[model samples]
Target: MNNTLLPAVDTNLVPVYAEIFLLIAASAILLIDLYLKGSRRNVTYYLSLLAVVGCAVLTFGDFNSGATVYTFNGMYVSDPMSNLLKLFTYVAVALTLVYSRQYVTDRGMLSGNLGGEFYVLALFAMLGQMIMISGNSMLSVYLGLELMSLSLYALVALRRDHATSTEAAMKYFILGALASGFMLYGISMIYGATGSLNIPDIAASAASGAADPTILVFGLVFMVSGMAFKLGAAPFHMWAPDVYQGSPTAVTLLLGGAPKLAAFAIVMRLLVEALPSLAYDWQQMLLVLAVLSLAIGNLTAIAQTNLKRMLAYSTIAQMGFVLLGMMAGVVGDDTSNMPAAYSAAMYSSITYVLTTLGSFGIIMMLARAGFEAEQIADFKGLGRRSPWFALVMTVLMFSLAGVPPMMGFMAKWAVLQAVANTGAVWLAVVAVMFSLIGAFYYLRVVKTMWFDEAVDTSPIVTPTDMRVALSLNGVAVVVLGLIPGALLGACLQAIEMTLRS
Candidate 1:
């Protein structure tokens, strides 16, 4: 069973205690939930929230202490970027739980005696993401990715009675497994070429012209394919719409948020950190991926009647923008612009997830028992009933559509700015065009909520905490859009400190 633990220095284990604490907390939540009365099940919920808070505090404190610290023989690490990303992940996951509580309860996922598996699995998933964000080696990255992927599969299928959910779970499991295999095969190829699974070693090998060029390129292609799939970028984004539509909204919220950060981390770790010498090849691949993703994702989303599917495609297009920013990193091999280019992509990813967290939170807010609120039509006349939430949704839509004075606009602009700085004006132009095209559906959602006649006319109900969170989230989106300097600077500094190769 390999119970013998690997020896780790104190510095390596410094930030690791947080992961251990979360593991213990998750197990505690599971055990504690088993004995609690159904009426007091909220205890587990609060405990989960507390655990997230605890982790956030720990990560935040760690961020101020140093810029980079490697551990576990360099398989794990802590740095400004990882710490900042972890802080965001904790907040995102906590907010997901808050928005999802009523939805799960109404569906009997937690109320009708569904076990605490949902909460427990969520913590485990967060743990996996944290690991991925901090992983410094191929083995650690793969392990973290699989851990997160497996938890999501279970979460999507948690409602065993929902046939659509079960179907989505099966499809997700199959596709996710294939993606993982592609990544693993690519890792093996890279290992064969460079004789190293460590990111820095791979970079050194590739840079020194020591690795087999053909094998490196081949591995790069497969790795990009796998990453594209994981990020739900085009040509590999087929599963998103179905999965989003089929899963419970709570699960959808979890799926849509936080994980993107982990995916971005892997991108930074593998392609950016491990193979910058192969930038020309991977950059071209990302170009194709970005163009296709924006085209197909935007063009297709306009026709979606389901809100979830609409957001699904929107995700693909947004990821295209991320690719554009990332591809700009190695222009002309000057390497001087790498930090801003990489940080632009990082900030873009964070902003997109932040906006998405709010958007999906509102979707969950509008939904109730017997009404999934899955359809665009379901939002008709929402403004009349719940103007506050309607306003929130409107802001979210405008942001997603990249309208000015909103976070989505700023996010898209940051990426485009980075791309344009690299003289990829044509790519920027295409991205902006698709963004315009994609606005139709987002604007459509906004219009339905504000202008259409009342269909349900039900009263709006939401928890006080969620209401507060929603307000703050919506405001943060707009405010950050207006003033993104601090956060963008933070991202740039993080990249400079940790990934300035």
Candidate 2:
């Protein structure tokens, strides 16, 4: 009776090699950091960078293969979209660490009790993002979201002694918890309706009309509400501005950059993959969110004097365009336009993250110990302070404003085109009008930088690494805008492959 053999697990570790390696690397670095003295903190930083590079190396094959491979009992997937997004996540995390090094160090975030936690937590956060990007099941996506959110919460509160930082972290944690609860409840309802947590199974059930429509729609509403909170789309964007403005600039960058990609990935997985049958319902919801986000984000940004707060509002507006692209994917039960529409959303998210990195990098570079350059007036006469960085900042601002020959313009145009292609010409027109209104604030920043007199003309000193990285960041925006074909083509191919598989 005891001689019965258990069935062997059918598991492939190859698909998760990057995640395994990163988890090991982060743990090793955390332990290694405990032994290193203050001066040796750079070792931990380099190790984290090496870990990111290793992830890229491991994921490169998957990206090139252009094949979809599922593992972890179909909870995780390795596909062109996941691989491409993971690669970009690696780049974003690496650049974030590089840009944050001096900023964190100057504020003692890298020394004393904290000692290298910034880098360690960032790696952990990246691990979460990778999981989110590859998640093929609702449970896996939720797990990844919590991991990333927890790490970011700690990062925001890193400056524990600072009242604003502590308060901001608390606010973020509370709202984040609420969003997670909403998502969890939605998942439960969906599982009850469809009898599955597997995304593809849910999709098949929904497509077959085998699930309870009333419960499904209710769950979908809750799910979309949670996602909107995560994406900083309005009506659910109360936490973004305060969190953005209150966290340290370095932490603010951490909150803004790669996580957006992960958020977008999961949105696609849940809405496009799991609930395509409810396309009209969710599209209407997205339409409302897009309009509200555009209106609130643009109009509110005009009144913001704090640069971080303004950018937070700007992020909301940018996400509005992304929502537009997302909503246009399946127009009137015809999914012929899905690939182009979704790819455009993907491109908008990627480009927005690229531009956001440079914008925050400049803010950090301008800040010194005990002085955060967070005010709009802080940029007064910045062009005279350091012409190159000022020009870099200008490029970044132009990109955010969706001005011509910058990456943002291309991103906006792509989304608008996607919307119009769906016969939503009026929606596209509204978005453009909001874009025009948003441009005023961005141009005002430029005006302050070039035309205003200096308040504190101290030399703009920056680390060489940051200088070079920022330069490349700015150049990438302009270059990508001018020759947008390659990235856009890649996005389209990735989306096409993902949907086909």
Candidate 3:
């Protein structure tokens, strides 16, 4: 290999260091689980927690540092965006481990894999996301995306004997492969047009007026399509509901939680950094997808009787709101397009992930062996059984519906304002309409819990660890909503960093 093609040998390797810590912890957990038995298995949980904490520490330790360092030519970079993404990834995965232990163990999802596979897979997925956030080249992006997706393919099917879990995994695998293929093809097209795979070079080529518009636009479409699939937007969201419904509750929690942070990072890289020149075309494409996702996600969710499935569609709609923020950032008619739009979009993404994680945490609380805790009916009179859980779910549902005094409401408001600032009045109207449609389902869940008669069966609540984690998970949602300054501030900083860099 040519020496010139390699990345800088000495640079801020803190990001890589975080991955190493996680790898070592994961391997150690696997070995310990293999040799140990019974209650000792729980040690893997603490090890995973340690891994996340270590990663978080590294993230902050490397804060505010910016370098366009290249390892393997221009394949990777340690920049502001990557740093911000890793921080969020750490938080999300940590919360997943905290809330998921009881759910996974009780459901038998921890069998045959040293009881630490979920944590290991989640860490690897985070590693993949880290790679994508730092990716400066097409090769890096594909590697990161595959690393994340492969782990998820197995994760969704964690309960191998469960028919729905197997089906969900199969669907996700096939669809994910197709999306990756599209992205790869688009990368090739972009390279053909620009004669380079490095993102900065592609942007420079476009700036120099040497790039072909046709090929670039074609590549942009394919790239956006793949991202849309990742974001679970309309027309590309066919897999989300099934996957969410089929996977174990803990897996659903993981699926919805931290990955969105990585997805946003990927979007920022591909659309905001690499293809800003094609904003008009992609903006229009995103506009249509946003409207469709909002409309379909909300309207269909109202008719769904399954809680996980409902949340699955709700997630799709939330992505629409995110798209609105992104469109405003890139194509708004407003004078201050860069930071204002970016801040709004990013803040929305951050808050959405937090709220979604908390929402899934409620689902995990009710999950136990021989009981999926997925259907809406299962929540009937839940208030009588567990008032605290009901309250937490209420907060999650209302926030998702954009009710005021909650972070989700603020997130929606910020994006809607950005959209209106861009003079996209119709898009804003669609968002409002969909919000109401979504509220119906959310409200139904609350009503079923508080007003409906209690079912005779009591949910299994064996694990002491889960009960404690679930309690915190519920409390965290309200706490985050009521005091969201730090999180929002971090998101704003992330936007500034990425744009300025």
Clashes per prediction? Answer: 0, 0, 5
| lDDT at 169, model 1 | 96
In angstroms, the error of model 2 at 134 is: 0.5
Q: Which lDDT value does model 1 have at 263?
A: 90
* RMSD (Å) per prediction: 2.4, 1.1, 2.5
Q: Candidate 3, residues 132-235: lDDT per residue as tens digits?
A: 77787877887899999999998998777779889999999999999988998998999999999888888888767799999999998899889888889999
Q: What residue pairs are clashing in model 3?
A: 6-73, 7-70, 7-71, 7-72, 7-73
- Per-residue lDDT, model 1, residue 228, is 91
Deviating ranges (above 4 Å) for candidate 2: 1-8
Q: Candidate 2 lDDT (Cα, whole model)? A: 0.94
Candidate 2: give the clashing pairs. Answer: none
Runs of candidate 1 exceeding 4 Å displacement: 1-11, 111-114
lDDT of 2 by residue, 1-501 (tens): 554576556499899999999999999999999988787899998999999999999999889888899988899999999999999899899999999999888998988755989999999999999999999999999999999999999999999899999999999999999999999899999999999999999999998999999999999999999999989999999999999999999999999999999999999999999999999999999999999999999999999999999999999999999999999998776999999999999999999999999999999999999899999999999999898889999999999999999999999999999999989799899999999999999999999999999999898888899899999999999999999999999999999999998
**Candidate 1 local lDDT, 428-451, one digit each (tens):** 888888888998999899899999
Tally clashes: model 3: 5
Better of 2 and 3 by TM-score: 2
Give TM-scores for every candidate, taking all chains together and pairing residue i with residue i: 0.97, 0.98, 0.93
